[model samples]
Target chain A: DAGVTQSPTHLIKTRGQQVTLRCSPKSGHDTVSWYQQALGQGPQFIFQYYEEEERQRGNFPDRFSGHQFPNYSSELNVNALLLGDSALYLCASSLVAVSGNTIYFGEGSWLTVV
Target chain B: AQSVAQPEDQVNVAEGNPLTVKCTYSVSGNPYLFWYVQYPNRGLQFLLKYITGDNLVKGSYGFEAEFNKSQTSFHLKKPSALVSDSALYFCAVRESLEDFQKLVFGTGTRLLVSP
Candidate 1:
């Protein structure tokens, strides 16, 4: 019963570059969501993916995008990265059901935009 | 728009003393409230959530929260604090009527339990 897992636990990228963060949802989970946690602040929602389609998105710019595979794994891509993009990217997974479900999160990938 | 508010930036309490972290929210419809704890350099860990029934919800790590509909508040509480309980606590809200649940988080409150 492994929980949500994220890849590239820590990475660095230069300005104007691109980065992709990967996430594997918890066992028996289907929906995947991404969040950005800046220094000294709580996480802000980026977007959510279900059935291989983006269902809802936050106020992020077009530079931020995501993909969900059939296996419920997800990838978050950020293009033209800026220094402000440097933060902890968290991946959360939950079940899409009528009732409220707990969203489990991964340790997150630390992105350092240089 | 739905939003969450954690008024205190930081809270300190002596070990073995009771502790409380306050939270308030605003949403057009019914809200699904949640509390999460984050350690340094770690991701958010789910503590508890208030969905429908039971205004008082008990969660992991000896934490509990009481939902007050009239005040739109859900304050996290613990009967006795521990040094290890020190961490950043966040309050989040999601509207029940929303088709896709996306949590709106507060600015977060740092809790320090001193010996």
Candidate 2:
């Protein structure tokens, strides 16, 4: 089974621009989560989506938003991107029952905000 | 609040030698600890976890972590290090009281296994 798949392996955007990253969950998984990892830092939780609704969120600002389609695919959108937003955006998926416990991650999309 | 700490920035070891990556955690209620390894340009791969059971938990890639309650530590260990085992290691903790299931991760430790 294809684990988690992310699109646009790498992206470059200027400050104030917006970008959208995509993810496809692994087979038989229903929950999707996003994380941001800065250089030399561990991954930080951004938000989680289940049943097409956001179940939990981290300390991120409103500019960072996401949506999970019925097909279990997810999209992470960042509006008015800041240079500080440049980092590796990771997508993780797991069964809803596992919830906040066990999850698998994708390779991640590297976002470079200039 | 839950937090994890990987005190060492890097660890150097020769092949065939045993390796240990130290991890300490702080959490309120029962702690769910986890270890993940990340290779260059790759996502983090689950290594092992300590939920409830024996203090010695074995995980993927021949890795095992010992959970010590007194020390509040869960150190990752391998019997014999291999050159291919070099990568970035992360320790994470999840507090049972927290609803988000969010994991607070450590800064990460880089392991270098020289052949």
Candidate 3:
């Protein structure tokens, strides 16, 4: 049973540049959600994707976007990144069940903006 | 809207002593509460959750949480602490029937267990 997996574990980008982080949902899971965790803060919801479509989104601006593939893999893209965008991007996965849908997370990708 | 609060920034305890991390929550309807632990440079690991059922919910690594409805609190507890248990703990909640996709998390509480 593989867990959620994220790529580009660490990366650095300049301000106004764009970055994309990828994630593979846990085996047997279909829903994927993205979160941003800043220094000394909890993870903030970015958005959730199901059935290759965004089902819900957070308070993020247009600069933040994401896409989910038919295979349940996901990509989180940030355009015109700001220094404040430097944070850990976490991808979580779970089955859309009637109840008790426990979300599992990946190690997360660390994004550093300069 | 659903929200969670972890009042303590950090909690220190002896390796063999019991430990407790406090959490409170608010939601328009019944809440689905969760507890996760995160080590440095790692993602959050699910510990336990209270969707419905008995108030005491047990999770992995000998962790458990007691959900109190009247108080709107769900505090994580363990019988005896281990040095390896030192890490950041987060409390999260989502309305049971509302925006089920969004989970609101607390700022987090750091637990330090000394040997």
Q: What is the TM-score of chain B alone in each candidate?
A: 0.97, 0.96, 0.96
Residue lDDT tens for model 3, B1-115: 7889999999999999999999999998888999999998899999998999999999999999999999999999999999999999999998863354588999999999999
Model 3 misplaced stretches (Cα beyond 4 Å): none
* Native-referenced DockQ of model 2: 0.59
Residue pairs clashing in model 3 are none
TM-score of each: 0.98, 0.96, 0.98
Clashes of 3: 0
Give lDDT tens digits, candidate 3, residues A4-109: 9999999999999999999999999989999999999999999999999999999999999999999999999999999999999999998886467888999999
Model 1's alpha-carbon lDDT is: 0.95
Residue A7 CA displacement from its true place in model 1, Å: 1.0
Stronger candidate by DockQ (2 vs 3) = 3
- Per-residue lDDT tens digits for candidate 1, residues B5-90, read 99999999999999999999999999899999999999889999999999999999999999999999999999999999999999
Across A1-114, the per-residue lDDT of candidate 1 in tens digits comes to 999999999999999999999999999999999999999988999999999999999999999999999999999999999999999999999988747899889999999999
TM-score between model 3 and native: 0.98
Docking class of 1: medium
C-alpha RMSD for every candidate = 0.9, 1.4, 0.9
| DockQ of each candidate relative to the true complex | 0.73, 0.59, 0.77
